[model samples]
Target chain A: DPVTGVFRGVIAGCGYFSRHHLEAWRRIEGVEITATCDSDPARARAAGLAAYTSADQMLEKERPHFLDLVTRPETHLELIRTAASRGVAVICQKPLAPVWGEAVEILRIARSAGIRLMAHENWRWQPWYREAARLIRQGAIGQPHAYCLRMRHHEGRGDDPFPAQPYFRDMPRFLVYEILIHHLDTARFLFGEIETVCAELARLNPAMRGEDRAVITVRHQSGLTGVIDGHTLHPSASGVALGDAWFEGGNGRLALDPNGNLWTERGCVWRNDVAAGYRGDSVRAAQAHFIECLRSGAPFETDIEEYLRSMAAMEACYLSAERKAIVSPLKFLVDSQSE
Target chain B: DPVTGVFRGVIAGCGYFSRHHLEAWRRIEGVEITATCDSDPARARAAGLAAYTSADQMLEKERPHFLDLVTRPETHLELIRTAASRGVAVICQKPLAPVWGEAVEILRIARSAGIRLMAHENWRWQPWYREAARLIRQGAIGQPHAYCLRMRHHEGRGDDPFPAQPYFRDMPRFLVYEILIHHLDTARFLFGEIETVCAELARLNPAMRGEDRAVITVRHQSGLTGVIDGHTLHPSASGVALGDAWFEGGNGRLALDPNGNLWTERGCVWRNDVAAGYRGDSVRAAQAHFIECLRSGAPFETDIEEYLRSMAAMEACYLSAERKAIVSPLKFLVDSQSE
Candidate 1:
């Protein structure tokens, strides 16, 4: 018997992103990822744990402390029900539901079951942004007036989706939901909850089902404006800068360069030492946070209800583009109750 | 009687910015500053030339080949009319009038008199943007889908406009019409004429008469969207980067840093050598373009009719903010005649 309440776990889904989940779980102290399951037999075996093609079988046999869910959105509701039926905790990856309402429903079910559910929103866990937010609260930049994050990359030009994430070819709610939700969440995490989301989306690449180019603007409760942008078609031979940002405040400015250096107006260049940690350090940090919250009775930073703001923001972005008008995410959430 | 047809000229308004005009004019080989005029005696005399407090006295007495009116908008129509009545060629500064209609009226007077007119919109002449535009046309970036320029400064925090020009404190349309108009023209210079201009403005600074922050988005005829931003409250300790831009095309990216360097996705860092010429190289560039157009009977790039596009775009930005809706410049121009 594991008398320490060692928190044995099983992580489902072995896609390319699943490797980070497995690696992160191994690094957390007092946690053992006792088994791994994937529909693909080879992927399941490759995780170097007790492999199973059946998630139900793994849950029945392992009876772990948590079920780490890293699967696609379509499989999320069924998996969540499966886990909740057994009364286990869950730390799931995002696009928790391709449909925003479905995500809300999933959260409602999990909360009713009294399970500790943490969505894998790791952008806020990234060191540079965390430090930027810390300094902003410390008046390093004063009251932020404008914020921008550019997440342009070159991995989306093919006629079909790239090999790594082959399913992306048909992600109808692509950039804003799949990739840009992280930025939207980060903005909310750094700034306060947004008041309105106004976005203009463009589908520049023929290969993708949804828009690949986005210019999303948000107004925060603090009367500041922000932009989260992606230009996948924007060519870059060498500057593989992702999530580069410039946050403007009343007294000073803090900008994050692609290379993890934060430039401030006070002539300080704080190299993001946190980002310099081992390859999966943010994942490790996130996992640690989840475990700590689970053990100590502290709430998860990206708990079911808390992470919904990000999820609502993502939906607002799509609706903003769809309607060609600014959509107030909070208002949308409130209005959806009547619907 | 310098026989090089040394286009003798009188420059009006020897205010703070007039020095750049005078310095640039002096650097141009065939132009001679016959006189300098300012409403303030001290300002006029400060310009190392035959000085007069009244522009009328200078134009009547000097009878130079051209007149440069660099004074405030309130005096532009009278000055341009004064010069045009004599059929002398003239170059005037921007905000041709506080009202867009008045600007159009002034241009009509100049055109009817056949006076060669150029607005001293110097930003496009800046070496870095000039080169960036050149490269974009040369297929450096495959086909621009997005562009952004950040024009932020600490000049707008106080009730009294800073030392150089105190009148900015009283200007009713500050950022968009005064500062961002250059960006509007530059966007047209780099991309095609804008089809729609959308802007959201805020009066973040309590002391200013007009908006201190603006987020203006434009859709170019080429199916690209661009943003021009100003956040006065955003703090920056030392990066006095002005007109910093990131232009994204299908194949590559072009960025201009405040330090006069253009970064290309091709891994080339082309130092903008033109910026090294003199304090007023861009002014000189604008003046040179004016003279070349005057001498060659070539129309000005910012000629009255062509320049109306910039003026119209500026009007659209203001109306967009006022209406909280996208305003088409050309459509607004057509609609304004009815108003």
Candidate 2:
């Protein structure tokens, strides 16, 4: 047994997040996925673990130490609450909830139960992001007055119905909350608490109910203002043809020099270097960090508190989008608390 | 005599526009600068021609055949109308007038007088932009379902007050009218007439009065949408660097692909390539084309009517920004006509 006594786990959602977690856990020593549960029985069985139809059955039978909540955002609150009640630490994917109130409740419940909660805000752990943070700390870009972070690609409509989940489809503002929060968390992790947020949201791609595009401006507590523009709807060259899908799919570039000067230039060119690890495989490294934190009670680099603050920023972005005005995080958090 | 008889010309203003025009006209075979007029007498003489205290004196004495109006937006209407009444074929730099009504009046007077009124919308003549247009037309990027155009650089502020004019200090929407019009024209030139425009304007740099940044979404007649982001506030970098200053600074990379792709990569990795004839010295080629058109009495590649339509679309962008609602260019133009 490891120091935390073997953390037997079950992945209850077998989607993209689940695939990443399952693969990472398999590589970590002393961690065992004793069972797997999914709505799709076939997918659950294919994982080579004892298959279960539901999370309740898996929790009741396996008595796992941890439950990796890779399910949809709507299912997240219930899963975390259940895990807390059963004294099972929860490692859930963001958004913590579809709405802010639900996210707060999940955090509150986990706190009362004294069970650890980790939101998989993995962009903070991505190699380039980590390098950016390191360079900024080293003063590479000279006090870092402004940053323009963008994640856009020409994504063809996938046959999978996962992206069109009800909680996702109906909420136009949640696209910023669900998708761009990774970049937001990345901003916070590199800079600090955001002071004010002003944003504009639009649904360019009519197929999705949510805003497929957003341009958000954030003023950090350090007086640094950063703009994040995200779109999953832009047209891009195919990854397979480029042989470097991660770097070449989108027309943007972010680099951190050895002297800590962080530079980002977009709308010029796209070149992918496979060897540099620009791909979105940093989730595996993030999973490893979570496991280490779970075993040693060492605070994770991106903890629940940090994720909650990022959530606060996300909620502020939605409010700014709603009111069509600039919103301060402090005022937003206070108002939400009153509500 | 270069076929079109020698024309005594008075350059109405002395700034960046005047500098470029003087350089181009000096090289032309037919025209000669008889007098120079500017609000500032010091600059008038320094601009390499006989100084005139005012346009009235310059026009009365020199009786110039052509007037190049490169003054501020507020003074454009008066300068253009005065020049047109004298049957002087006018070449004016853009934001032809501060307001659309004024612009229409200027256009009307020029047409009534049977004088040529060229907007000097030089972006259409920019080699790189023209090359991008050609490639898209040639199906290099395969129909270009979407385009992301960005124009940003770091040098809008400087210690020298002369470079930053007085009108420039308070012009509330320079990006939309001046800079973005270039990209907007490029989009329309490459794509087609924009049907609807949705935009978000922000004053990211507090030092600048006008919104220094804007993200505009244009829905073209062809069902293709384009996102054009313009900023005069981004810190100086190699890729999006502006003008002769960038070439002088020497901070970017220029390479040649044996296959005729003239590649320039900035931010260390983003590569953009255009076919050989369309690369570096293509600005001179564009100028040469303009001169050839003038000599042959042939229509210029970028027609004034087409440029006016692009200006109409740009006006829609400002309306969308102010109204905080999607503005339709086709509707706006029709409504203006009806009114």
Candidate 3:
């Protein structure tokens, strides 16, 4: 495939999100998904590729140029290790691992093997945030100082709310880990690095195990601060952008309505037209970036080493809620170095 | 005069906010502002009352039944002390005192002298909140669990903003003390007693000595939580309500728009009709309650003892921001008892 100028790719875990990855790889110019693997043969067959129930068997036989790991957080490490030993590059999904120690191990494995790795953090690639970043750089909001995203999703209510993802009910750490982590990553992508985090979490829905509501405040190293007021049990007008957002600056403020329209004091700056794809076709965009970087030998925007900082910030949110104090994510990173 | 049902009153510190108090007092029946006093003779004379440079002189000459203290936070303790010694019940403007110790001393003087004291804390008396309380009690938004107020004010920008209150630029503590304290009081009035407070404070404008922005999170004793996200240097649609608010509950959510209209998921629940006076003429409503309670010998709703909790919560916000940890307002109250 390399001699023929084609980049062959294969995906592990043909679960709910794997469809997006498959479709994206199909659309990219020079990339081809050689096969799909899942523990469940039915799910693997659903991908309509060279189906296999064993990822190791598929990797050894197909020997694809890249592996896309879309499995749950716990499965990520072993899958990455399998790919790394075979000298196959990886694009892994986020939270890298559920806990900090596992995440550090995953990173160490990737670094030691020298395999190209990227975390599939696609929220920042969502057209609205991308447009907001453009306008911010264009002086649309003039020296931005703060950002706020009020996220409301009604799917976490009732006894069996998350029917699509039943595993959501049993998770000890729910909203911040599974959901708001994307916004945290988007915050980092838009505003510089985060320095400190403080959060107040509550479980509004008693049927669920973890906190459903949270007010997370983060201060960037640039002294620009932000708050993510999120609740999964509340009624929201639109789920397209998750919720509405406002980015405040000295001269003006930018607002992202639920319809994915970005507005400044002047008027509507950008409008989101296509609603068919996944979150403004962000998965496709993110996949395209991964493939392009592999071909060009350029680094991924969300390279594994750098993404550990986002993981640390997410860890700090839980720590802040537990200790009822502000926590520095840098401590987690510094401690991880020793490990 | 007691038999004839006339209540004579004197007002001290005839400055900017004093006008609202004076207007409200004039509108209330069976009460007369017999005189006004201020250190600046021009401001004192502007009230169109018999004016004096010394508050003690006005209190002696007028022999009013009550004193309305509309002075700054630093002046509150001395004014309350002066009024209490002369057996003049006082209605003092808030922050109650700039610090907890002086607030305790002010309460001690009022209690020992047996003079009735009420804090003129009136944001909760705003018609929109009154309607919200009614709706919440009516089970419109079922079992409210959280509340959020995103407050934006454009008056704190540029080199010389806040022209009406130039002293605003020099205060060691600006927004939280002078402004957001009202929202905190209203939070308690709407939700319940606050148990813990967490806040992140920032000064967006270099001209101000204190913080111009804050994200304050409070957990109530009743398990309800609220976030007040406020910044003074950003553009907002309306200054009438100061910002917009959302109250989330089990069944639905309640929204308060900038025009003071309250909305539920079904439709507009409450529409604010009158725009005259200060914040829905809440000052007038608050003054009316004070006079009615005085004549009927009923207790003031914001009696010094109860109002202290709101002040303590305000103090806890400052402490939380300073220590970078959650602080309990009860600790401040308990410590004040020993003081």
Candidate 4:
């Protein structure tokens, strides 16, 4: 197997974002995407692989070495269970699960199964953030004290807001749960552990059940303070690619424009150059990391534990908004552990 | 006095900001600055007017029609009472008093004396905000649903953070009380009364007694949600001058750059060419309004009642930060009224 080790991979869920994952898996060398499964047969057929209605059917039929669960948060638990039962390594899409208990259960299943599991949180892998982290590490911005990410998309306007994902309007816990979770994980990746989160959420669009706008103040364990200001109701100042971000420190500020350029006001010279693929080929990078870790028997960068931390942070943000107080992400983790 | 209507005004407390007030008063027609007072005789003398060590001495000897109390918040009550006793109209600087009870007492004193009083809340008079308000009124950005102002100055870093105002290090309450109070009043001036406020405060600078950074989420009575994210420690995304802001509505967004240019992306075109003087010569405009009101028997725009509301908002912001909950500024007003 080692002499001719070409691992077979199968994708579960062929939704809007899954296409990126599919493309990425195909690009990663020595990885063959055996088949794709989606609840919607049409979407499964759209993947252009051996199609299956159920992940169990695909896992049994293909016996793929790995399962790429690109499904929604709700379906992740069952799909991960199926993958684990089939003794297949799995890379699941975030938030891992919809709630804290389910996320813990997912972690538990992965641990018991002893299968290689990775949470596909690709925002941090976005070349700009990686470059930002490198800059910070290089002492470009001396002792980074603050960071802010403002993500505003024009899609949450007009009659048909969120055209790609219409279900975004219907989710009770949108914004923070659906999107800012990526930012929260990315924040952790860039700024280290989060100590506390105080958030204010608003539902600007009448048709949406959940909050369309959110401003979350994050206090890192390292004493760094930052804000994640995001909304779907309006376009961002930088014209809404992934919005804009800035990392401020002792020297100066490192800014990420909408077009994915990471340049500083002065001194620090770093550029992302707007690479090809999705968000600087972050999906490809994320998938490649999973495959490399599996081949080398190395731990995942976003393992179940790290993903749980990000998930807890998201939970804390929602709780802070509801309670009108600062919430510690650690409390959720500790609570879940006790339970 | 009605024939010429040349009102003689004297300045009390010749501090750092008081210079702008003095300059503004000098520029105003039909208003002559007869004298200036400060406990520090040197500061009073620097005004190049008839100087005195005490406001009482200045008020009695100058017999001015109005007193511009440019002193600090703690000194406001005594100076205002002195002006009231002399039956002199007073235009006091913001935070009418440091505490709620003192501010209410100042209001009561003004009411009982039946003297003309105004709060020098000059930020709303800033040419950009004025243009922004006009644009909103003209439906440039449609019904405004959200606003965010981020003010970051480079002064709150290193050993001596606030060089201009060295006393900033000593203030028990900073940021929101000293600076963002202007933005809160400006928000009221632009988008009606604030229904609730939730804030997260941090002290990034080690030497400062108070929080140097804050992110205050404001929910206006008109359902407009906004944030005032400010810090003294870092330079803003735009340059240091007033940071940047955006008012988002049904149509698009109205953006205000650091250089005082207010413009929309596609349709609307409203601009504020940076004018001379302090923050669009707002101090001059505020003084002009006060002087015009004095001459025409008209009410002051930032009269005692309106000033009290801004004070209440300031109080609520502090309380919200302390209690870790959303607070209504109206409660402070009600509590004061009952007393």
Candidate 5:
């Protein structure tokens, strides 16, 4: 039986991932959306939760078990720090902060205060990716030497309102931190830790201030090299709609489908041996694991300390892209972790 | 009727394009293959022409009108310079030399000797590219914003020998010069000259010295931007195996197919309203144009002087890849041209 607690929290944003998070929380037993906050009053009220003008007001009125900070990256550190100070455990998004220094600071504060902090790095919990990881561990793909992950979309303009935020639009490290972070973390999750990164960032469209395209090469600690290419400007009809992982090893090539199927090549023939499905219920599974850890005092699978290193890796990529030189994640992390 | 004693030449290497160049030379009437040379002694003797151990022997004994230096890039400059000094007006292959300095010196020597040099930049002669150029000129694609050309091969091992030497294996730039030169030249041919270039080159297999993958973006003198991506590493069963070109204007979008087909989209619908095919036969057509220019004393369509700038652009790409920074082709060319 699940532990019973009064699960009252404030959702500080209503955007792309916010809807999914809100819906997931609603489905979880004993969880209640006590309050919601957004700059747009209409969107905040439309969520059907008790709408509040600000996070401070909501926290004062309804003290909650967890603060689900789904706002833009710029607001993440401040909210998490405030939540930690106010004695609320925090569940922040994939990129803990817009910058690496702030991400470290957030983690440091949470660690010192002994408050639980979970970075919503859902890619590791992604069903397809998890299955690929399992197959890789099972030696289905031999010793992986090289991997490629690509996520591309042609349409840049969208009806989605989240990207309209001033920070999202103005951030120079948009592609590196926003989208590629998931893939970078996924690379770390599958191939141990990234040791070095060399990357190129381009703003293909003149109308956009931030980069819409990136091609990054990561060298892992396990001697596996990988390239992750992300282009938000690619055409939608190009059949490669989702990112895929292609692993080349001594035995043969194993291509992990976007839907979690495994295609292996042996001798001269290729076969899709795995069923086309997710490994399991990813979001609920991760949420359940987090909740279990929170209740039983078991160690969290993806702790804030581990995620801070990934954030440092992303910062190295940004510096590499800007400086046009290879950046060592280890060096960056050493300095970042020192403080 | 064409003038007599203009020049005579021999097809030194015979392969796919050798036959085409032979056919074109035969049609020109004045030119003659006094001899032919192929390292494969069997094919050389079978052609019923006096065969020689080397190009120098062919030049000394046969004294042909010109040397159709159809061999690989490594032999291009030496063969052209030898023929030009012997008073042979030479028509060399695209990518006149393996590297920029060699190409520059070849042009310098050819100019001093009063010998005409023409690079077989044949994409300009392809009817479809010609039509695309016409449409762009006619404002059909408006002021061409960003263009993408993807040239790919499903499967080809490194063992396949062509013409003389295994050009692809020795020079990493062969893939850049032999294949991508067409697209780069076409982009410049249609969109005007390139000003600055930034590129990333990858060799997927370390055993293969040549780069099998490349993603290059150029900023043109016309204030238009473009991207070119090519790889020999794509899956064998991938569909169509061609490239795409996107031209964005104030009005709508115009796209081009790998085989030179054209499509225009305005508001709602897309219309495929262009011809289709390899468009490679334009090599012969372009050669024909060069022959006509020689006969009429008209300026060649692809002037060697003008093409030297494009060669500089190619060199800039190499420098950028090596130095990992943006390079200005014009700045690199200034010293060479002045010298």
Candidate 6:
């Protein structure tokens, strides 16, 4: 560690969610978040780390072992390229890219340069989801055949979510890209890679330019049919409740109510009172996983190569909605990869 | 009402559900259920009407002006033809035939014989659904853009819904044909006729011969996307709660809980306590509507010709699921009708 007692990391994009990432990195025993960078100096300063307005400046000065990208997807490619060239392992946020082709190319470039890359797919690491997956693997639900997550965060109701994240009101790719991607990636973690995607999207909120609601049906390779049903304009019982979800198998069903409780068809309920603390649960777990992988040379759970499957599913959802059809996501992704 | 003070009707197939039909028929004014016929003499006798072992013998002896066919889909075509040829207006149970081709031919035969025909697609006529449709038309939820009915009757469990209706366990096409067709019809009733269908089916109930669970996505002519998600193996809060449903438009959302409670996005709850009555409130309304049309020469709500819209959607669901593609039900039905 160059006589340094701890592993080093730099985080870019001091947005609304970066606090969780920085806090998470800080919580990890072996790591220190050396610097936090954002385009806006105020946001950088707000993070309370050694702040830099330019990510390149932070990377040059801190020379961190890893770069944590909590920025918008538009900036991820440049950050990944900028960091990977300096032999920095990279962890970018969900979606990975604005589109699948670009994500594929970005990963290809990173891999060719021998850089360890991972997507910050945190939903799979969410405390409740982690417990749910554990039970699922233990056959609590007996071979999961169907999974559904109904998303109705109601953030787009008026100016609520828009106030915290103003760019959401104008993004061309909103619901599925900015939000539902987490659920889709979680579906992959719980169910496996998706095969086909049949989707229908609606712009429920007139103020937003892109779709705020969508119903995406995904058929997993394991014969598991998963649906990511969403309505950003509708509120749940509580504001924190993202959605109600269930994974059904032959013998029983595993359900997650909007209130963050995991329940089973057989009448067992689990609550995750142990919040992830400053890092947030999944963000903490995801960053911890990346750090461990960096140190021990262990394979990442959401390595860019594997994370591309969820991205491919996301890409297919858009295509399916556009074409009004069920398109095979895995087949399309695999074919594109071959090309 | 030929000054006789009675509207005579003969009902065929005295299965378990027929008792509800007979009870509701008794409640209707000016109606005399002259005969109840079944292939089995005991079943006919159990119906407690002027019993007959054969429908043809009952028709010849009683000379009823209308026939209600409550038999299985396999027998639907023959019974429809038998009654229609005698110039009797007919009310037949749904899944008019075993397949789309046969259903098409049966309707064609009825039309050729100049006899009126209607499918007993009663879900649309349910009290809550009717109210929902009325409110939707009145713009309670604004533009009526999306619809979803998640079916979780759990009736297909081991031997629960089997002992009474053994045929369901044996039917080659169960859920979508016998059940989801009702919701698809309801979608049309609430929104408009469907233009395209994208679907996926699963046979969760190993005991059942056909798929007991399905997700049928229908795009209506009005640009409304409706999902009839069926799963006969999953239980809801109660056994009687058919499915949870919602119809979303630009302004708000209209939802029906797994129980009978119907509500709006504005938080107004509605419960249809009057219930559909013995024959199923919808079945009663459907029959009453049929009788009114017979008396006043008005067109039937689910008249075979127009009702084919829903049947087409159901047919397309099978095709879409089988082919893993979206299909035009209207185009398919119209082309089949022309053929």
Which candidate leads the pack in lDDT?
3
lDDT of 2 at B186: 67
Query: Candidate 3 regions off by >4 Å?
Result: none
Q: Could you arrange the candidates by TM-score from highest to lowest?
A: 3, 4, 6, 1, 5, 2
Better candidate number, 4 or 6, judged by lDDT: 4
Span of ten consecutive residues with least summed lDDT in model 3 chain B:
B231-240
Cα displacement (angstroms), candidate 3, residue B141, comes to 1.6
lDDT of 6 by residue, A53-128 (tens): 8889999999888888999887788888888789888999876888777787888779888999989888777778
lDDT of 5 by residue, A67-177 (tens): 788888888887787788888877777768866778778878898888998887766777666767887897776666556776654454343312545355556667778
The residue-by-residue lDDT of candidate 2 on A194-295, one tens digit each, is 887766676655566777666676667765555676655433332321111011001223453322233544421223232322244566777778888887
- Which pairs clash in model 1? A249-B233, A249-B234, A252-B235, A253-B235, A253-B236, A265-B236, A265-B237
Candidate 5 is graded, for docking, as incorrect
Q: What is the lDDT of residue B79 in candidate 3?
A: 81
Clashing pairs in 2: A140-A259, A140-A260, A140-A261, A141-A260, A141-A261
**What ranking of all candidate models by lDDT puts the best one first?**
3, 4, 1, 6, 5, 2
Per-residue lDDT over A1-339 for candidate 4, one digit per residue giving the tens place of the 0 to 100 score:
366789899999889989888888778899999899988999999967899998999999999889988888899898888888878999988768888899899888988998878999888888878888888898887877667888877778767778999998899999999889989998999889999888778888887889888888888898788888888866433442478888877777788887777778764365566556687899899999998898998888899877899999999988987886778899999998888
Residue range B1-339, candidate 3, lDDT tens digits: 568798999999887889999988888889999899999999999988899999989998999999999888899888888888899989888868888899899889989999999999888898999898888888888888778877777888889978888899999998888889888888888888999989889998999999998989889998777888888876544557888898888778899998789998788978898766898899999998898888988998899998999889888899999999988999989998876
Best by TM-score: 3
* Candidate 4 CAPRI-style tier: acceptable
lDDT against true structure, model 5: 0.68
TM-score of each: 0.89, 0.73, 0.97, 0.94, 0.74, 0.91
lDDT of 2 at B261: 34
Alpha carbon lDDT at B67, candidate 3: 92
lDDT tens readout by residue for model 4, B1-339: 467779998988888899898877777888889898888989889978899998898888999899988888899888888889889999988867888999999999999988999999998998888988998998887878778887877778878977889999999999999999998998899999988888778888889999888888888888778888888767433352478888888776788888777778774365565566788889999999998888888988799988888888889989987887778898999999899
Better of 1 and 6 by lDDT: 1
How well does candidate 5 score on lDDT at residue B186?
78
Q: DockQ for all models, in order? A: 0.39, 0.10, 0.65, 0.46, 0.10, 0.38
* Backbone clashes counted, model 1: 7
Q: How many collisions between residues are there in candidate 3?
A: 0
Cα RMSDs, all models: 3.5, 7.4, 1.6, 2.5, 6.2, 3.0
Judging by lDDT, tell me the better candidate of 3 and 4: 3
